[model samples]
Structures are given as C-alpha cells and as structure tokens.
Target chain A: MKMTPKAVVIGSLLVLAAVVFVAVILPYADTNQTVPSEIFRSRVSEEAAGRLIYIQNGCVYCHSQSIRKVDWGLGADRIAQAGDYVEDHPILLGSARTGPDLSQAGGEHPDDWHIAHFINPRYTRPVSIMPAFEFLGMDRVATLTSYVQSLGLKAADRRMERQRFWKQEAIKAYEAGPEANVRWLNENVPQGWRDVPNPYPTTEAGLARGHVIYQNFCLGCHGPVGDGMGPAQPWIYPPPLNFTILKGREVSGGVLYYQIMNGITGTAMPYFKRELESQKIWEVGDYVAVYFINQSDANSEPRGIDAAWEP
Target chain B: MSNPSPTYQTAKGFCLTSAFWMIVGTLMGLIGATELVAPDLTKNIGWLVFGRVRPIHINIVLFGFVTPGLLAAAFYYFPRLLKTELYSERLGVVTVVAWNIALVAVVLTLMLGYTQGREYAELIWPIDVAVIVVFLMVFFNFIMTVKQRTEPVLYVSVWYALAAVILTACTYALGNIVWRPSSGALVGIPDAIILWFYGHNVFGLLLTPLSAGVTYYVIPRSVRAPLYSHTLSLLGFWSLIVVYTHIGTHHLLQVPVPTWLKVIAIVDSVAMVIPVMAFLINIWYTAKGRLGEIHADIGAKFVFTGTIMYFFVSIQGSMMSLPDVQRVTHFNNWVVAHAHIGVLGFAGMIALGGLYYILPKVTGRPLYSRLLADIQYWLVLIVSIGFTVVLTIAGLIQGNGWLNGETVYRILPQIHPYYVTRASLGLILVIGAALGFYNIVRTLFVRSGEAVT
Candidate 1:
C-alpha cells in the first residue's frame, strides 16, 4: 500500500514506454502505410550519392526538408508525409535549428544558383549566415547542389521539368539580344496584369520611401542606379534588368509593378511582395519611374473613381 | 568520525562571486532586450547596437555570468557530497579569473566586430582558446577532487558534473575547430557540419549536463532525503551521452547531406526524450512532497523552477527537431525562443539557485536579505515566462507568413507589436537583474548586517 519512490519511478517509466511505443515506435514501424502523393518517388542514384556528402559535411544543421500547412505561408507548396521518408531510417529531422528548412526544396532554383549559394551564401543572399561551402570544391559543390535539388522527390522532378522547358526558351531569348529577351520576359506575364496601370501614384514622399526600400531589398540584384548590375548579376543568367531601357517605352505601370512585386521567377529578382508591403512596392515603382525612366505616373492618376479615400 | 562540517567555508568566495555575476549578466540582458525593441533606445551609440550588445549580453549572461556561477556551486557541493575538499581551491579560483578574462575578451571582440560570425561561436579564435583552457583547468581540478574522495559511493550528481566538464573540454574544441584558427574550418560543407555539431552540443552536452548536475546535487540536499533512484539517474546520464551526440546532424536535414545521417539525427532527436524525461521524472519525484522545503530555501526554489523550465525546453526542443514541427519553427525567432529557454530559463535559473543556495552557508551571515532574494526570484520567473510567450508568438507569425508566401513586408506589420512587448518584458528582467546584482554585491562586501529574521 506504500507509495515508494522505486514503485513510482517504475510506473512512470512504463507509461513513458507506452507513449513512445504508440507515438514514435508505431509510426516508425508502419512505414508501409505512409501516404504517398503523386509527388512521391525515390531519389535518383546521383542524388543518393550526393546525400552521403551531405551527411558527412553536416548540411542539415542549417537547413530542414519538411513543409507543413503552417509553412504554406513561407511560400511552401506541400506538406511532408511519412511516405516521403520511407527510405529514411534515422530521419534527419533536426533539433537545433541554426538555419533555414530544406524539406521541400526541389527545383526552387537552377543548378547554377545552388553552386553560387553553396560556394558562399553571402554571394547570393548578401546577409546569409549559412557559411561558405567553398572548401567543398567545385566538384563537390556541384554534387551537393544536385543533392539539394532532389529534396522534393517527384515534386522536384516536375519543377526540374519546368526549369528545363523554360531554360531553352530563356537561352534562345537571351541570344537574340536584350530587346527580344525583354519582350520574352514581358510576354510571359498574363495579359491582364501586363495592361493594368499602377494604382499608386508617384509622390516625393513615396519616391523617398521607395529609395530606402530598394536599398534594403533590391540593391542586392537591381543595382544602385536602377540598372540590373548588382553584385549577384554575374552569377545569374539573363542577369538583372537594365531599367533604363524601359525609359520612354510603353511598358505599363502594371507590368513594372508586377515584376517588382512578384519578381521575375526563374531569375534572381525574388518576389519582394513577401518582404515588402503594398505601399513599399508602390513607392519603389514610383522611384524607378522617376529616377530611371524619367517619367512619373505614380500620383498622376485620378483615373479610378475614389471609393473610400476621395474625401 | 569527525563531524561533516555544514559551514561549507571553502566555497564561500565562489558563492559571492557567482551571485555578483548573475546580477551583472541580468542587467546586460535587460539592456539587450531594450535595444531589441526601440533599437534607437540608446540613440544608436556604438556600444549599444543590437549586433554588438546582444553577443555581450549573451556571453556575459551565459559564460561570464551564468555558467561560471553554476560551476561555482558544483565545485562547492560535489566535493562535500563525496566527502572531500576541492582538489585545490587555488585551481578553482584560477579558473574563475581565467574565465573572467575570457568573458572580457568576448565583450571586447563583439564590440570591435572581431567576430567569427556564428551565433554561439561568436567569440573569435583566441578567446575560444581561453575557454578551452579554463575548461581544462576545471576538468583537472574536479577529476582530481573526485579521485581523492573519501566517500565509498559516487553519487549521480558527481557523475553528471564530471561528464559535463570532460565532454565540454572535448566538444568545444571540435565545434570551434580550435586547431585551425586561421580560418577555423576544414574547407566548405564539412566545416558547417563540424561547427553546428559543436553548436547544438554546447546546449545538449555542456549546458544541459552542468545544469542537470547542479539540479541533482541540490534536489536531495534541499529536500532532506536521498535520491529516489540512483540507478535511474545513471541511466539518464549515460543515455543522454548516447542520444545527444549523434543528433547534431538534424540541423542539416535540409542540406544535401547523406540520407542515412539525417535518419540517424531524427531518430536520436526523438530518442532524446527517453534520457531527458528520465532525468526529469527522477528529479521531480525526488522532490514530490518537498514543495514546502523547496520554497523555504530560495536556492531550492530556483532549482525547482529550473527543472520545470527544463521540461518545457526539452519537450519544445524535441518537437522542433521533428520535420513536421520544424516546418513551422525553423529559421524564425522560434529557435531564438528555444535558445533563451535553454540558456536563460533552465540554465540561468539553476545558476541563480546555486548562488543563493551557497550564499548563507558560505558567508556565515544569512543572505544580506532573504526578502530581496525572494523578490528577485519572482521578477526573473515573470520575465522569463513573458519572454517565452512573446518570442514564440512572433516566431509562429513569421513562420506562417513565409509558408503562405505572404511576403516578408506583409509579415512585419503583424509582428511589430510583439517586438515592442518583448522589449517591455525585457525591461522588467533588466530591472530585476540590476536589483539582483546590487543585492548580491552588497551581500558580498557591505558591512551592514541585518538581524536574521
């Protein structure tokens, strides 16, 4: 009848054992029943080979591979499933998160981007703490890039397919000169967005705010002069845009806003819509219009009937 | 047999010094928190930039302030429990002085931006060497002390304390790449692995063990009872070593590392609960009916609360390590939350406990004021809890925004208010830290003595 310490400890251990058996051990054993999506598949042999280097070097320390419903806001696509880890035994679900997650990282960028990033995160990200893998050498860096590219399994394959398809078009467009390439880029934007006018107008205050925003967010690629000659330009193909060329051209405000806000995908111009606000986007667009293009339509429009702010 | 002396005089100096550091560290932490919110709270003075001040705050609060403070307690008690004099109080003091020097170097390097640019490993290489040197000195002193112990039975607390010192001596060297100071790396990808392997272990091995060692030592003594199960204590200790060592690879799961290694990391991270909970259950049970005993002793109160914080931190740490859990926690302030919880909540609390536990006995004068100590205890508890809530909410918002492709700009407005709240809570901790430091320093050197009440 006595509640001895020994008895209490033993009983608690039993409960813990039961909990682990159900929560951890059971799921691990039932790997077969793991739900596989259309995106699920095994890693290619090359990717598998690259994984060895990943483990030996400790890449997982800074990155993670899984994305969840909550992660949809992080620009994530799909949630991870048990089937995605079917081949995994120990599972590299990291604890001490010193860096970003990598679970669903497939075809997010081209192979070259990985190389430059792996060589030194700062080269691409400017302020990254991900550490330089330059010592991994070009050959190993290439191998590491391959492994990182295979993170999403079949999902990565689709992205890779898209990249391959667009790469040919992009290369051909570039070969034809900047005029053809700019046309090719603009042509890709959906028709509606291309014709739309920038709703926000250019104001002095707006232009100043845009200048600050551009320095913090876009200066890494879009040069200080509004030309695409930022530090990361050489590393990126089709480089950053030369905004001056759009001067006096009939490029709609909507087109410029779309490119600035959404970023030209498959290029180094990452979408600033996530890091910047709508006001910031409008301000920066006005800045480019005034400084680079020598034009200002930002505040010029009384076009749309004021619904709420007309007072 | 000669009566075992209860005065515990030899460690009196350490008790005084540790208390002083706790107060100083907390003050720095408060200032650091203020800077986080207003940023220009100090008008952008070079000394107060978040970049410079944050590292100093962390180091002074951690190494300069907390770790040494805890080690002092460990030094005093481990020898007594084993029925031995510290192998050399002389060596102990030497370690303390050397540790202070390293901390000074940390503040200077951070201020000068002579940083290695890693989070915990921010101290440049030379100071890193000083840390290793201090560890070696402490290790030598403790191991010698244990070897000469008069007690026939080695308590679990001693085992943990010894393991913590020895492992830190090794892991710190490996993690910092102390050998190659020029670059402090092995080229590319391997360097990242090595650095993080050391980084997480700083928490898992060094801080965890030392904190647990102090807890084990203080629990039974404060409760006036023998440990519930010495066997379970040892099981927890050894299993911690087994599971914690290989889990470093979990940090790299998103990289192009080998799948097998990542598998090892994830499994072990989950497996970590076994050892973690083992220690928690054993300690919690040891003090089950001793709530009054714990509350009666300010030191025990800190340790008891620390044990609870450990429960939250370890569980959170385990969950964050999971791929599913990490999807929402990674690269955000969530990890920062874990860091503070582990460093400040769990380790920092125990460090204060260690100081208070030894203060009365060492000074032979009741704490300059038990009332002040109790006040400090509440201030710290409130501030720490506030930090956990605010930082966690901010992390969730940032993580969710990124996942939804909500754009970084859009997320800033959502979390700005949380940052302001965190800064305000930080001010509370800062005030508490200042009060604690003043009380401790006054206790150590002031002549005025209040009647023991």
Candidate 2:
C-alpha cells in the first residue's frame, strides 16, 4: 500500500465521518425520541436559575443524578429514566459518586437544613468531603438549594408538600414551649415503639460508641452538650431539639430510638434508618438517656431473657 | 538558505510551553487531591474549590502538558521526514501563543465558576472555539509542510500525526457542540450521549494518536531500525479511528441510554484490542533485540516504558467496558485509576519522552541534566503506578460497599487512607513537574551550566 498523504488524510477523515454517523448521529436520533417520564415537568424560572448555578460550580463532578437498579439497597426510591431530563440543556448525569446519588434528593431535607449544608456540609454530615458554598452568598446558595430541592421533579414536589405541611405543625409545637414540644414528639411515636425499652444495657463501651456516633451524626445540629446550639443552629429552625428539655418528661428509650432512626421529617432532623443500623440506634438511645436527660429505663422492667452477646 | 538558520522556533516554543504548564497542571491535580484528603484545606476559597480545581487539572494536562509535548516532537519530526522546513514557523508560533493564552483563560474562567459543566467538555463556548481553531491551525501547518516535501512517501508517523490533528479538529468541534454557544450541549439523554462521545474522543483522537506517532518515531529511530512491519502500522492507524471512536458509548453504558448504543460500545470496546495490539507489536518488535540501544537514550527509554503502560491501560479499559465489570467499575475511583494509567502512565510518559527527545535536537545542545530527566521519569512512573494501586483499592472498597448497601457516607473512613496516599503521591508528582520546568527552561535559555533551581 502506497502511503500517500491524500490516502492517509482522506481515508482517515472518511472513516471518522462514517463512525460519527453510525455511533453519534444514529444514537442522537434514537435517544432524542424519548417521551417524558411520569414525574417529569419543565423547570420553573427559579429551578432554571439554580440549575445554571449547579453547572457553574461543577457540582456534577462529585454528585451524580443517575440512579440504577443496584442503588435500591442504598435507599434509592426511583430509577433514572431518559425522559426525566427532557428539559435539561446538558443533562448532568455525573461520572463519579464522590458523594451520594441525588436523583431524588429534592425534599430529602427542609430548606433550612440545605442552607446549613451549603454553608458547610460538615454542619450536617460530619465526614462529608463536600466543599462549602458559603462564598456563593445567601442568595446564590438559596438559588442552588432550590435546584437541589427540585431533583426528583413532581415526586420531589409531593415530598416538599408533605414537608411544608409538617413544618407548620412542628413550628407550632416548638413555639408552644419545651413541655408541649416533648409531649407532641413523644405521642407521634407508634404505641409499640413507645413502650419498647432500650433493650441494650448502658456500658462504658456502649457509651463510647454512642459518643462517637453522636459527634459524627448529631453534634452538628444538637451541639456537643445536647443544647441544640450548634453552628448550624442559626439556619435550622425549630432548632435541633434541645435535648436538655426532655428530662422529667417520661421520654422513654423507645422515643429516643424512634426519633433518631426515623427523624422528625418536618424540622431539620433527617432519618438515619438508611445510615445507622438497629443496634447502633439502641446504643445511641441509651447514651442520650443516661447523659443528656440524666435518666434511663435501659435493662429495667419487662426485662426478657438477655441476648447471647449482651455483656 | 539565509533564513536565520531555521531555529525550529515552533518546536522550541512548544517545548517550553509544555514544560511550564506541566507544573501548573500537576499543581492543580495536587490541590484537588489535597481537598479530597482534607476538604476544609481550602475552605470557602471559591477559586480553589475542588470542583473548579479538578477541571483545571484535567484540561491543562490534556491541552497544556501532554498535547504540547507531543506536538513539540511532531514539529521536529515533520520537517525531517518531509525533507523540508515547516510551512510557516510564524503561524506555528502564533498558535503556541494563542494556546497559552487560552489555557490561562481556561484557568480564570473555570475558577470564576463560568463553565458548561460536562466532564471533558467543561470549557466555556469561547474556549471550545479556541481549542478547535488552534487544532486546525496546527493541521494547516503540518499538512502544508507535507505538501512541499521533497520526500514523496509519507511515513506511518506522518499519517498518525496528520490524521490525529485533522480528526481531532473535527471531533472537537462536533463533541463540544460549538454550534450551540450558550449551553454547548443538546437536551437530556442526547446531551449525555454526545458529551461522553466527545469526552472519549478527547483521548482517542487527540492524546492516543499523538502518543502513537511519537512512539513510532522515537522507538525505531533510537534503535536505528526500520519499522518491523508497515502493514501493522497501517492496520493500527485505521483500526484506531474506527474502533476507538465507537467505544465512547462505553462510558454511557450504565446510564439510561438506548440498549443498542450500550451494546455497540461494549462490543467495540472489546474490539479495541486489535488496534492496540497492532501498534504495540510493531513498536515492541522493532525494539525487541535493541533494548540496550533504547536504554542508552533517556528519551527512547521513556517512550518504550509508555508503550508498556499503554498495553496495560488498554487491556484494563477493555475489561472494564464489560457490562458485568462496569457494574463494579462505573462511578467510582476504579475509573479514576484507569484514567491515571492512561493519561499519566501511557500518554503523559510518551509526551515527556518526546519532549526529552526533541529538546536537544531543537535547541542544538545537550539537555541541562539527564539525571533530572531520569528523576522526573521515576517520579511520574511512581505516581502512575502508585495512583493506580491506591485509587483502585479505594474504588473496590467503594464499589463493594455500595453494592453491599452501605451508603456513600458510611464508607468515607474506609477510603480516607487511600486519598491521603494519593495526595502524598501527588506531591511527589508536583515536585517532578517543577524539576522538569527548571531543566527545560535552563536547557532552552541558559546555554551553559547544570540546572540549578
């Protein structure tokens, strides 16, 4: 084969054009024909503005929006669909999961929690490597927050609706003072969970483990002394329950356990069911009872047979 | 021949450009790595945020360090092979200047949080145009040089270089969606499909082909041997364009893309072995019995080692493209490891090799210090392998943990140690870049003395 300049140049470009037609153009035609998924809706002006901010900050580098079937175990509620992103100018299905997938991140938390997180993710998640967006100022952060809170589209709106309704109830309880707030919170727990004692006894080792969990997961909002005056207090309203107020209120081990595991949805508290296991939750509940409220029914009353591993 | 001695200004300029920017590029990478280790390390410093720093590191390494280094060698090799001077050194110099200005603009714009936000396609619309224009400028310079050649037959290296420049010019424009300036992307799934296609081409058409061209030139010339097989060379060139271009869809396989597209990507990704092996066999066979000759030349030594890394990276790439393999590899540091091996170990090594090979030839002097070049070589080699090992382990921990139902946050502590190791390794790489900069600048400017940084 004579390696002429024309042969090399013309032949290679022709090959490239043909491949582009097959690999690129053909796929574009096929995938572009997708209809909107059920939850899909056009972005409003606020969401559009926030989406631009998301793009500008390169947030897609760390966070992903694409949820897969395998993510169901990791608390995924919905699998991503092509049509869900119909209006996105550049669909930001990121490559890495340096952070969690955000396919349904909208309404996962209240606006105030998002604000504190924007100021510093460590304010909510102790070990989060996400950078602070405080430099964006409150306005831009709020804008970015709006975009984040709209991640699940219509499903997100439905979640946000529930959040708004519960938020008003939570605020009303909070303003009625600590006594009423504690009663209301305690009553919300199921009858079965309300009566279930913290099955695990409080040991020094258990207290240590609970302390570590508290700092990592709770101190951001609840403060080191459980006073709820943490750094994120200014942003999160109905302010992370003043744990000091639960004393003499007959708040059982089950109430602590349930709140920690299920979280008060309307306020800033997030459910840790996906993050913490059962034993850890029990241990943490005992830790709080002994230290913060200065009371514990752990290993008391209706005491059944001890577990094989209980020390 | 009264033309101021044909200073090879174009090649020398690119040599300096590549050497200088390697420091900046590697520094950005080090910064990003440090943030991963200690996210608060640069807290609230908007310009230094990890997200912004990451794109700076990637784009600079691609357009700044590797591309210019490979081009330096191509500019030197083109005239020699064609038996004529460059078509216009003046245009070449303008292109280099514009390239540096554009890189500066890239850093500024991205730092200011003005980006289009697609990986490998993050550059704003204007910078995208700058990239395509310069590539076309480079193509014009090379193709014109080819036309006026006293030599009639084009070497395989020339084919790779010409095809690379022209193909990348077209691919860059298409991939970047230069036609859509405001957003620089299509809508929805099509946008994602196009972005990955363009992202992969950033490597396939640009870095891979340029690295192959340098390997073809440096390996045989170092051993004073003719290419072991011309047929293998042709096969490699054509197969690369066809096969590599089809596999960008592999990056989109896990997404909600059409199943047919994923199949094409998977099948073609595995088929990538043909082009990779063809190029390797030809180069390795040429250097087979002549390891001693290649070893004696520091330049050839670097290029040859890159070929070995290329073999590993391509094989790993093919395996990871498998759907089952991708289930474990996608959206994790496993892909990060693959990138480090490909960019740093394979193409980056070849780029530096070409830089070393051409520096003395273009400058008409021996390198300031071969020892520094050797040190830099080991530094990059260690960074490459070290990154692969550490990041891959981190990726496995992440992938398995995710599959096992642990949330991404719960696994943070598990990967912290690896991120720390990666950052430390990054420091060593940054030092190597500084050393390269000192050596290159001194060699180009300081006519005498050892490189005293």
Candidate 3:
C-alpha cells in the first residue's frame, strides 16, 4: 500500500459501500419481511398525523416508546418486540426517559386529561418538571393526545375502552349528586381496605412531608385544598374527588392509600405506586384524612405496621 | 525551502471562523443543559426550547467548531507536505465564506423549526444542498492541489484529508435523502437504518479521519521526530474505514432492524479495537519519552490528551454495543456521556489542537497568550471529564431506577442534582470556548510585534 490519494479515496468509498449494503440497503430491502406483532396495526390517519406532531415537538427526547424485559419491574405489562415498531418511521424508541415510558400510555388518561396535562403538566402533576405544550394549541393538543393514546396500538385500544366504560359510570354518579358520587366512589374500595385505618400517627413533620408530596404528585388534579378543583378539573371528567364530601363518609386512610396506589381503573386517577414510595403514599393519605375529611383514624386500632421512628 | 512571505490566508480564515463558532456552539449546549435542570426556564420560548436548541448545538459543534478547525489544519499541511502552494487560495477562501454562510443558515433554519427531523440529518433539503456544495468545493480544492504537487508519494495526512471531504459529501447526500426533498426519508425501519448509517459515519468517517490526519502530522513535528510506524498508521487508517462503517447498526441493537445486521454491527463494533489500538500504539510509541516536549507545546498537549480520550471512548463504545450491556445503558444518559467523550473529549480536543499547532506557522507569530491557551485547555479537560462523571452517574441511577420499576417521575428528584451539576460544568466549557476564541482571534489579527522561535 503506497498510500496514494486515488487509492485512499477508492478504498474509503468501497468500505462505505460495503457498510451501506450490509447495514442499510440489506435491511431496507427486507423491510417488507417485518411482520406486524400481535399488538401492531397500521396507524389511523389522525394518529399518524399526531405522530408527526410528536416528532416535531421532539417529545421523544423525554419519553421512550419501547419497553424491555428490564422494564418488567417498572410496571411494564409487556416487553417490546421489533414487529411492534414495523409501522413506525424512525421508530421512536427514544433515548431518554425524562418522563415516563409511553409505550402503554394509550388510555392511561382520557382525552380531557391529556388536554389539561399538555396545556401544563403542573395542572395534573404539581411536581412534574415536564415542559408545557400549551403553545401547541388546543387542536394540536388533541392531535398529540390521539398519538399518545395510540402508543400501545391494539393493547392501548383495549385499555382506552376500559377507560371509556368507567368514564360513563363515573359521570353518571357525579351528575346524580355529591353524596351519590362519594358513595359510588367508596363502594369500589374493598371492605378490607374500607375498614382499615391509617397505621401511622399524624405529626407536623409528617404533614409537611405529605404537603410536599401532594404538591409534586397529586395537587394538580386534587387541588391545593383537596377539593378536586385543580386546574385540570376543567378537563378531567368526574372531575377529581372533592375530598370534603368524604368527611362524614366511611373513607378510611387505607381506602385512600389503596385508591392512590392502585389507581382507579377507567378513570383519570392514575396509580402513584410507581411514582411515590409506600411511606409517601401513607403520609399523603393521612394528610387527606386529617385536612379535607376532618377526621383522623391515623391512631386507630389494628395498626398494620409500626414506624421505626415512632415515639 | 521556506518562502520569505508565505501566507496561509484560507487556513487562517477557517481557524478564526472555527474558534468563533466554538463559543456559539458551546453556549447553545450550556443553555440546553440549564433547561434540563429547569425545563420551565425557557417556557414559551420556541426558539430556545430544548428540542430546537439541541439540534443547533449539535449542528454548530459538528460543522462550525470541529470540522472547520480540522479543515484549517488540513489546508495548511496539505500544501506544505506536497511541496506546492494551494492550487487556489482564492477558492479556498471562497469555500470558507460559503461554509460560514451555510452554518448560519443551518442555525436559523433549525431554530425556526424548518428541519428534516432526523438526528444528525436534521438539515433541510436546501441546507443539505449547501452542505454538500461546500464539501464538494473543499474536495475539489484539495484534489486539485494534490494534482499540482511536486511530490510523488502521498503522505498519510494527505490521504486522510482527501478521504474525509469526498466521503462526507456522499454520506451527507445519502443520509439526508436529498433525492426526496419532501420528507427527506424512506418510510419505516428502512429510514432509521439509512439515517444511523449516515449518523455514526459522520463521526467515524469524517471527524475520526480528519483528527487522525492532524495528529499524524502535528505530534511528530512538535517532538521533532518521525512517526513510530508508518505501516501501523496505514493499517489503522484502512482498518478504521472498514470496521467503523459497519458499526452504525450497534445503535439499533434493541430495535427490529435484522438479526444479521445487528450481529454485524456488534461484531464490527468490538473489532474496532484493532484499528483503535493500532492508532494508539503508533501515536503513543511516537510520543514515547516526549511527554515534556508535548506538554511544553499546548497544541501537542491537547492532541495527546485527545488520543487518551479516544482509547477510553472507543473501548466504551464497543462494550455498549453488546445486547446485555445495552439493556442497562441504551436509551439513557450513558449513551449521552459516551457521545460527549467521543465528540467533545476526543474530536473537539484534536480540532482545537490542530488549530493551535498551526497558529504560529499560519500567522508567522507566536500565540497571543500561551497562558490563556493553557487555561482554556485545563478548563475544557476538566469540564468534559466532569460531564462524563455526572452524566454516567445519572444514567446508572435512571437505568437502575427503571429496572426496579420506579416511575420516571420518581427518578426526576433523584437525578435533578446531577442535571444541575452538569449545567454548572457546561458553564465552564462555555468559558473555555470563549477564551479559546479570544486567543485565536488575537493571535491571528492582533500583532504583539514579537519574534518567534
């Protein structure tokens, strides 16, 4: 090899050609061989339009679409298969998770919830640091919501169906009266959960901690006053729980914890089990009981577990 | 053989332009880092949003700071090594002017949200054409210069420089999908395959080779010695071109691109160690026992540090391509840290080194302030290392958190401090870039009326 310029250029081109052939051309030619997964389907035109909006907004920077086996512990119901992304152009298996994985985000919330959240994440999650997409406008927000609601494809559609089903029941209970809605909401809690009271005692420090957690995770929809009158209330149906109504009801700390941790399926109340630790959940439940409900069963009998730092 | 009045105006122009853009590019990076710490920091500001600013920072760094700096040295050495004046200094200067104009267009269009929306291939069709034109012009200038050379056997530096320009011209065209001006893409997985092929090569083929060329020329000259092994250097060069090209698919290992393609990408990624070690062995052997000489010359010091960074980044790159390793590291800040090491730590350092090494020769004057150059060097080295540490820790925490089934919001409070630390470190790099720009500008245009060595 005398290292001539002509030789260098020709050799470099050949190397590049080989790579393009193997890595690019070969795969491109075989794209039709990529069979759609069980969950995969062609995007509806609206969803496809929303996908473009998602790309334009660079939402992929903060959210990942693909879930792996490692994500199983992260509440992932299914691991991503390559066939799932057969229809995705630039497959947004995004690089960062500044926000939660949206692989199963379809039907995670109703359109109204997404609209409010897009307007400002703080409206739904007080502590959320996600940038607001209000500038995308209401129409674009609807488009974006559609795309997000289609994240898990067929699986997402099934989830959305459940949400729609519950949405109707919740609206029916809500329109009847506050007493009826409160009774309806508490009826969904199991008797074991309804009977259990808060195990942890209320303290100023505990309340303060609860206050902080509430602001970051719950204040957006629950409102600062625990009245379910947060900014997102306008968009969320069954309009978050107005905790004052539960003051005289049989709403125990355990019931609050169960609902917050497991999330009310088919409603806008998303599960906080992944976002908040157990202690934070207990504390927020106690805060809700003491402040909004005007009752504290925090020191009731049959305490499940004693705090190590308890006096 | 030195002429009484040898003016490298084209090289000087590019050197100045690269320094100026380095400041702008790093500032954009700093803004993006700050936004990460506080997403609402630039709320309602469309142009300054993370999405838009990220591409601007990346495009500017690639085109504005690193490439021009490498080309500046290439222009200077190509003529000297070939025993000829540049085929056309006027054409070279025109290319420099056109290069800066295209860069300005890249920033404006991307900021205004007129992008093709592919990573590394974000430039719209018009700007893509502009980019291809400038690269073609540079290639024409260099190839014509080679034709006019009195020397017969082409040195390794000439070969590397010529290869970089021509190869990039083709890569940019194919990657950007210039043929399809509307979407700039093929539909589905095919587009991702082509886009990444162009993406990784932009670094592997362009920056790697150009930086290597500058290193081969500057290291030996600074120490007043010949290269340790010409055979090893050529081996490294050819091996790099062969191995580096196939490794782009390593990025898609988790994707559904083909199993065979993934195998090739992973295999070739590990195989990169051969060429990487070959280059390192050759350069380190050449600089053996010459640490004092390298340290004395700030340019050689930067280049030397770059070679060390190259070893770390290349090895890390190989390990990250594995399916098991990627399970923990992929789609996270671990890759971000790796990218910083490759682009900023390795390539950016060498680009700066190339500029500094040729400053005196091109200007016919010693640096305006060697102390300032030293400060900038330490600042860049420390901040880049700081970025690697902070981002890697953040990545690990996120990876483990996600593995533990912790929600993304839960990880936010934990990683907030790291983002803050990264932003603070980014400020240091911005300062370093500003200082380097000042030093280069003063060195070129400001005369101290002092004699050189």
What TM-score does chain A reach in every model? 0.82, 0.97, 0.93
Give the TM-score between model 2's chain B and the true chain B.
0.98
- In angstroms, the error of model 1 at A295 is 13
Question: Candidate 3, residues B88-156: lDDT per residue as tens digits?
Answer: 889999999999999999888877777777888888899899999999999999999898889997888
Steric clash pairs (candidate 2) = none
Q: List the residue pairs that clash in candidate 3.
A: A73-B405, A74-B405, A127-A216
lDDT of 3 by residue, A133-248 (tens): 87778898899899989988998899899888888998888899988987888899888888888888899999999888887888888888999898899888778888887877
TM-score, candidate 3, is: 0.95
Q: Write the per-residue lDDT of candidate 2 for residues B61-81, one digit (tens) a residue.
A: 999999999999999999989
Candidate 2's C-alpha runs over 4 A off are A73-75, B1-5, B448-453
Report the lDDT tens digits of candidate 2 across residue range A93-171. 9999999998899998999999999999999888889999899999999999999889999999988998999999999
After TM-score superposition, the amount by which residue B19's alpha carbon in candidate 3 deviates from its true location, in angstroms, is: 1.1
Could you tell me how far off, in angstroms, the CA of residue B373 lies in candidate 2 after the best superposition? 0.7
- Model 2 clashing-pair count: 0
DockQ of each: 0.08, 0.79, 0.56
Task: Assess the local accuracy of residue A248 in candidate 2 as a C-alpha lDDT between 0 and 100.
Answer: 85
Q: How many Å off is the CA of A27 in candidate 1?
A: 27
CA error at residue B27 for candidate 3, angstroms = 1.2
**Candidate 3, residue B209: how far the Cα is off, in Å:** 0.9
